[model samples]
Target chain A: MKTKALLFASAFVAVAASLPAMAQQTATSPTLDAIKARGFLQCGANGNVAGFGLPNAQGVWAGLDVDVCRAVAAAIFGDATKVRYTALTAQQRFTALQSGEVDLLVRNTTWTLSRDTSLGLEFTGVNFYDGQGFMVKKSLNVKSAKELNGATICVQPGTTTELNLADYFRANNIRFTPVVIEREEENVAAYLAGRCDAYTTDISGLASVRASRTPVPADHVILPEVISKEPLGPSVRHGDARWGDIVRWVHYAMLEAEESGITSANVDSLMTSTNPNTQRVLGVTGGMGAMLGLDNKWAYNIIKQVGNYAESFERNITPLGIERGVNNLWTKGGLMYSPPIR
Target chain B: MANANAAAMDAAGGIGESKLMAWVRANLFSSWANTALTLVVFYVVAKAVFFFGSWGIFNAVWIGTSAECRAAKGVGACWALFPEKWRFILFATYPFDEQWRPALSSAIFIGLYFFSAMRANWNLRLPIAWIAGLGTISVLMWGGVLGLSFVPQERWGGLVLTLILSTFGLALAFPLAILLALGRRSHMPVIKSMCVVYIELIRGVPLISLLFMASVMFPLFLPEGVSIDKLLRAQIAIIMFAGAYLAEVVRGGLQALPKGQYEAADALGLSYWQATMMIVLPQALRLVIPPMVNTFIGLFKDTSLVLIIGLLDILNAAKVAVADPQWRGFGPEAYFGVSLIYFVFCFAMSKYSQRIEVELNRNKHR
Candidate 1:
């Protein structure tokens, strides 16, 4: 009887030890499965950033970051509207994604080495190549960021921008007073109320804050200098390589579509063209979509429904009078480049 | 003739004054000191009213874009933004086409609230009415049946989400609080200690911490692949937090009850449950009506804290509204609009609670 019980216990331990490996093989990417089962993509977004993810007067979310989520949804479900946005603050965005509260976080979160390694998150790619910049009143006559020596600058605490500010000032051998605030709005309000001579944040943030929060847009000027690299992107939990691949390729596909001039308006005409590259991207020639465990027409659906990277940029970012300087395609001498679909 | 003339003069200037003059005297200028103070206050108040009225009403830009608002700068409030963005502020990210569902649900909730406030509705039918009302609201908001389009709980926002969190939180908390109150007073040492620990632990933390735990930490404790909706998690946190405070209020009521009531029920051969339900709870609950309503009001306002965890309550929706590039820099107007809505709801609750308190205490001797 003792030998029989010991044999049963040994069998149980053997099965239990191999259970995780079997589970991993069966459900390769639970995030993708949950998303498909739910019939919509749960996207975390910045609720307050104007040109990034704020909602419109009609209660529809429209912005560059929002477009990335929409493109992902279009790629997965072939419907851009098949997405629910959870507006998360900077403090809550990571935990929301990590806890599976949101499938993808496309908030204007700066991708840093620490976040990538320690936060159990994988940043797909830089959707918006942002950089830290300074904004000051036009009346201040500070044409260059270097001119603001001994000035009181309002900045949000616990952000990469704060670190960048200190580094830039020390490098230039300039002295300045730091007026640290907790919230983005408070920093802007402090700047507008003349409590600070300048406000430092991402250039896109400066444009949005000036365009949306300033009483007069012409009153504020974003400085010409780009101090620190802030590559904002979509992120998913680590270990979901399939989900990460889908998000990464969705961005790449958009950029490739832009470089190839295959816009949403002309995707149908281009789909039937004799061009092998277009055929491959439209899924008539290659199995790129299948490699990501998606349908052949996934990239095609993304362009057809949510448009390319340029279209999203023009639609959401251009209204703030922001020129797509470094965000332009590689063909136009910008850094935006995509791997060929074939 | 001289006396009559003196009376006529008095009526115009002194003792037997006209009604309007008497009112002015009583309210504004009874004495020289009062007259001087009233005049100074009136001057300051009138100047403020004039400036505000001119800016908000007379010289305000009523219909235009942000460019137009800027053109009218230093003149008045940008009233045009309100009409353009009121829906976003009120319904938030609810699908534009399906906004009517949230609108209808809010109406039903308000109707039920007012119905429940009336003393005449305080009976068995009240609970039945509440159940029916809440069920209809759930069907309307969730919308997986009755041929209505399905709306998930995450899409719910603005005033509708606020009312749901508060109403449902209070509804679930009330009974749990009653049980906790009884448990804390129970003869069983284990039950009493458990109840005491729960109350103290929850009450020791702020609502924001509880919400943060619900949003961030709670999922870590759950097994993998099992998840709760963000709104539901916040609602649960609200219920738990409210239950602790409500339990204390209920305990206050239970402690105030006379010992003879328990003895009387025992003499009548009543069981513990029966004695508590029939003889103890009704009287104790009535005694704590004011405090109980005060707790409900606090819970209603505290529901706004869910926005910290990304649930779009009315206040958060207001922030989103002004964040729009089209209506930017209209923070004051947007906040004022939201505060008005909150004031209306909270004011109604305050008045109702006051009325209930009076009604409950009307027959009391002291």
Candidate 2:
């Protein structure tokens, strides 16, 4: 068994090593060709998650990740509404992308090495920098995770949050009991029923649960400590290098637009800006769109149609009561940084 | 008649008590232990009914918003969720103003089912009416012409989609199932083996795997520029799956028919097709109505599995509707409504099947 595993591991390494060389053989994207033929972009999205990607009561899709898909559509077709969304469960998302059912997956998927390398997928960039945190009742008078040494935590089984909870407590030399449930709603119900002292999940999920699931939002407080990094992003199929570049730059353009103070309202007027960065981003002076096989107004179209990263964040995530602590741009002491457009 | 019987009983002096009291004593108060058991059961059942009645109807918030429902949570059901989300649950992401299309289409489908269920309509007129009715439903749903806005199949969802999938699925599959059953019974070696292979191959796997393949894996096999509609793919998968299961039930029916019936048809110098169609099939099909309706109801409920493929069937639409931030944690109310919808359709099928069974078996009972 050990020898077979070693053989499989080495075979995987060989295949992984040859992927980049194979990717360089194609300068054009078959996915792009198909999208152009179909006259719309197919986006695999999350129908269940509230802020990241979900449909409203009218069946209209909205959210930060949804905006990413819209931005890509705007960049390509110069029309954000040209994208059609297919709501996918987590198990279906990767297979949907790999099988070419969707051009890209803009669901809230965490970027990990195994998924990146073994699954033949390319993580474009992180749109939401999330981390696991504990949410406890404010009446508990607990301000930090350190205080929950002997308390029971409610967590969903088969999630990274469960493993992280154990690692965090064991590393801190604190013993605690876990009330593990399979379904997330049941887990939250357990926490809300006082079956456990604390509920641990991603901070964004905690915020969503507290804001929407609980009776009173102010009664629950997310602890200060974030135990693990969860860089959620969009992904495309491996070896689709040109398509990967387009999806990647869509994220960066949104960030650059946020940093340059350009938004959907002001993008058309910012066409005559004097700054070189603004001119290049808005496609006034530089033919940057041609390099990615698009119209020169690609970035401008994205900004004009879908707005910048900040606008989307405020529009979607803000309603969920999530703060932009780590998702803010680099200028505000956050991790969201984009390379120069030129 | 009751008074005459009572006078006769009193004249006989068997018992002075009325019939109601006699029945009560015989059934409920026969002995001390039985009486005690009956009272204990009665108390528990009464308590349960009272509890549920209070929770589901009496104390439930019916004429208010989510806030009112939230306040009444854990104590009473939020029945108001139905009024608030019924449209969303029924129509899903279809255009709001155009929701009337699906509503009317669903009514038309139910009308067609009702018309087809009658014994008087079992003739060529039935098929003609069905075709006309189904054509009208398609036009109403798609609506490219007739001065109505065009809606694509992708936007089709909710109860309408569920009905379309199952109704068309079983309707198309029933004929195919009959053919496959006949083919399996064919005297030719190739035809028999082919039917056997097809049925076993499809029945070997669960319906979900086939749906997954159609939704997720089948696209890879298509050429780069070609793609089929996801709904069409899922519908085909469902029909194929139902065809295999229904074929087995039909084959069982064909096998159960007496050999003398087929021999009688042959003795009248009937050909193979005539013998099978006139003599064998009528008895065989009548014999298997119960099991065939069982498969039909099963297929109808199994349409909910399309939710996994991201199609907004009724169950998936309810899940999405309750996921709205304004109305979360009302899952029980939403699912109760969904279950009621499913139960109405399934129970109707079951009751209709029983009626047909008794109707056809009248001669046998005699």
Candidate 3:
């Protein structure tokens, strides 16, 4: 009886000891394994933000952030359509990612020190290099943000825009009243109703709001000055190093594809090119894709299915009247530079 | 001869008078004060009506881009965008080709509801029919067999999701509520306190907090590798919240019951379960039908709150539809469309409840 009791206790201990190990393995890349098992990527996005991650009348998701999701899907499954989008609001985005409701959050989220260090999240890379700008009625005849002294501006509360507006005004010794609104649509309505002299937000946001909310797009003009930097990027939950690497590399691949002049239309032909840089990017040589635990054709699939970064920007953002600005490649005097794939 | 002539005139006036004229006199011009008020009100209402009619229908752009809508902006409403974007509003991110499944499933659900609303259909077969109907909807929606393409639950949205959440939330909550009601009234102290605590705790908090907790905090508490579906978590929160309120409603019916009913069941030597089921519950439940239906209607509207947790119910889907760059300024049209849909469903449910109440009262009298 004593021996039997001891054996039972020992067996229980053994099982208990192994349980956490089993759990650790599953928890390490829980999102990645789940995506593979489900045969699709679950991406959190801003379904209402035009030129970032909005859906069209046909229910097709468009915009730059949406393209990131598609590109990641292509890299993983070799099919861009193998993605499901969860339309999340600003308040719900991080919690949705933390709870594993989505494999990735590719919304127009700004990367910051606090979010990177404390939120248990890792931002993959900045997809849109944005800055805060002002929009005023053309009747105001304000060509620059500096001219808006003593102006009442409409801004969304609890955003970097509010802080930037305050900083810019204080630094320039301009007195201004702020009509803080919570919703984007409400801000636009307040601005149009003359509640404020100007509407302040990220430049891309101002362009989108003006295009969509104004009866005549020409009635509103975005100011010439950009006050603060807002580098919007995709983010993933921490503790998944391999998944982080995969998301980061997918972004780099798009920029690299654009720099190498490899359009989706000509990616197949470029796969046969002898040039070492194009060959490395097209996965004709090098094991970079394999290092990320993907097939050699992963980068090729992303370029062929979702196009390069330049194509995505032009397709989604260009129509909003937003210029490439600093989002263009380094070769074109922009900040977009990717390390060699080799 | 004068009296006869006067009587004949009165008779002629009464017989030949227009019904419209009489109605106007009786309803609109009954008193001098009423007549003045009515005329003033009529003028104001008419002005508003004509303004809306001209803006919304007569001069509105019917089908065009934002530019066309803008050109006609000062003259009329920009209604052209609705026809172009109605599909996205109705179906949300649901795939275009597979939309028929959600559409057909929604129709089936409504048909089942109408069928159950008939007083004659209230029997054991009702539950059976409901189960069969729900099963069919599930098969159609989450298809992996019968040669249909598999659409995951994450892809479900818009009106279909709204109906599913409310209907499923109410159906699941109903039985749990009854159990809670009985437990609250139970002689066992432990069971009674547990029931009381659960009901009161859930009732004390708002549904949104519960939903937020379920979507965010609940996952953190679970062991690793165990994940719940986002829609399911929100649905569960709705059910729990509804169940608590429903329990109190059922308890109201239970308290109103005469003690003689229970005493009579005891005198007949029936078991506790048997006595409650056969003798007491039927009368109590019949009495509570009106309040029960009121609760159901509230639950139906409360389903829209799921939008906060990112489930695209009909309201959220409509918001998303007009959020496009091309249709940004057409929020009024989108909101009006969604409000109409919500009104039709809630109004039908209320009307059905009135009919059921009348029918139940008639049966009680009989």
Tens-place lDDT digits, model 2, residues B48-138:
9999999998889998998898899888999888887888889887878898999999999999999999999999999899989989998
Model 1's CAPRI class is acceptable
State the lDDT of candidate 2 residue by residue for A230-341, as single tens digits: 9999998775577889999999999999999999999878898898999999888778888787889999999998999999999999988898998989899999999999
Q: Pick the candidate with the highest DockQ.
A: 1
- Give the number of colliding residue pairs in candidate 3: 0
TM-scores (chain A) of the candidates: 0.87, 0.91, 0.87
lDDT tens string, model 3, A225-246? 9999889999987666668878
List model 1 lDDT by residue over A174-287, tens digit each.
Answer: 999999999776788789899999999888878877776787789889999999998889998776667888999999999999988899999998988998888888898877
| Candidates' RMSD to native | 5.9, 4.8, 6.3
Q: Indicate the residue-level lDDT of B257 in model 3.
A: 95
Q: Taking the tens digit of each residue's C-alpha lDDT, what string does model 1 give over B231-250? A: 88999999999999999999
Best by lDDT: 2
Please state the Cα-based DockQ of model 2 relative to the true two-chain complex. Answer: 0.35
Predicted candidate 3 versus true structure: per-residue lDDT over B1-366, tens digit per residue = 999999999888887687668888999999999999999999999999999999999999888888888788668888777788777777777788888888988899899998898868989889888989999999999998999888877778889999999998998999999999999999999999999999999999999999988876777655444678889999999999999999999999999999999999999999999998998888899889889989998999999999888788889988888777777767888898889998999899989888878877896678
In model 3, which runs have C-alpha deviations exceeding 4 angstroms?
A: A1-34, B1-40, B363-366
**Candidate 2 vs candidate 3: which has greater DockQ?**
3
At residue B161, give the lDDT of candidate 1. 92
Error of 2 at A126 (Å): 1.2
